[model samples]
Target: MSDINVNHILNQMRSLSLQAAGKPVQETGGSTDFSSLLQQSLASVNETQQRAGRMVDAFESGASNISLAEVMVESQKANVSFQATLQVRNKLVEAYKDVMNMPM
Candidate 1:
């Protein structure tokens, strides 16, 4: 087996991440609310997960067009997004606890 370029993979992942977020690299200076941003991000993650699942199914059924590396990269993207979402949830919970514990 030949070595895959780590940099290339990372760049591709980053590109997909930006596209998935549904935001341009340069913000238009328009104010975005936390709720909307969060919603958009969650939607993106869900979409990524769904796409990966489909890719896995296709590959498993002996899809000639789907390559193993493509499936793997898609799977990794889903995992990374999920992990980030989990961390965000954890922090939000911690913040709530901290606020509740603060002296009145």
Candidate 2:
């Protein structure tokens, strides 16, 4: 949830719906390509995980400015994002397998 934007996801779904209905999608600043969106999402998740790790390291090193509550919150955020990414990967693999097994 930390790296995931619900609004962005909803917008993408809306765009896809428009495309399926043979309507033009409006121009937007964000990349609409699937690969680009996926890359950006993965990068966000990576950043979140890295940030959490750094915070944990700093706290373990006796950093006075860092608080246990902040570290825990960041760590949980990272874990949730990672879990979501893993689930997405699993679904993508399943989809690929299904497409491959579709016979002519």
Candidate 3:
């Protein structure tokens, strides 16, 4: 899928979460809440992880006739998504630490 499609999915997830939480939709918004953004990112990462797991299982179980190349591509996609999630988590933690250290 295109990068725009991925971004669209993320935005939809964020909007759903905000609506569920009874928060006003941020129209003409200055900025989004970092924590909500991170949560949506994590959700997407989890989806990728699950898809990878399924691909591996299919390869091992002889249930799917999918090619090795397809399996490998799915695995790589999961790996890259996981690494991206890790980086986002690290940055969020660092930002939190900085905020905590600041004088109130």
Candidate 4:
């Protein structure tokens, strides 16, 4: 990958890490709204999935224009993100169930 693309990806990853760590991207920014953060994370996951789907479609369509390495990387990213989301959902469901079963 070109230096620019690599730098962009690294920057994005850094931003994501900061968000996940409950650190604002800017000093002037305050606490992030939970709903907004959840929505943004979901949107990012959806976008990754869409990109992976497009890569698969391109490959199946006999388009050699897209590099195999790029496709693989995107696919792996989508898979990992999906798995993380699924795990989070599972944990949330379990917590809710436990709460509901608790004595008042």
What is the C-alpha lDDT profile of model 2 across 1-104, one tens digit per residue?
49997768878885895586466777565546788768967897899899999999999999999999999999999999899999999999999999999998
Predicted structure with the largest TM-score when compared to the true one: 1
> Could you list the CA RMSD of all candidates, in the order they appear?
11.2, 10.2, 9.7, 10.9
Q: Count the backbone clashes (under 3 Å) in each candidate.
A: 0, 0, 0, 0
lDDT, candidates in the order shown: 0.84, 0.87, 0.77, 0.80
Candidate 4 C-alpha lDDT tens digits along 1-104: 64566545655775788788476774313344657767877888898899999998998788979888888999999999999989988998999999999999
Residues 22-82, model 3: lDDT tens digits: 6676652335576776676678778878988898888888866877888899899889889
Report the number of the highest-lDDT candidate.
2
| TM-score, cand. 1 | 0.74
lDDT of 2: 0.87
Candidate 3: the clashing residue pairs are none
What is candidate 1's local distance difference test score? 0.84
Error of 2 at 84 (Å): 0.3
My TM-score estimates for the predictions, one after another, are 0.74, 0.73, 0.62, 0.68
Off by over 4 Å in 3: 1-35
Which residue ranges in model 4 land beyond 4 Å of their true spot? Answer: 1-30
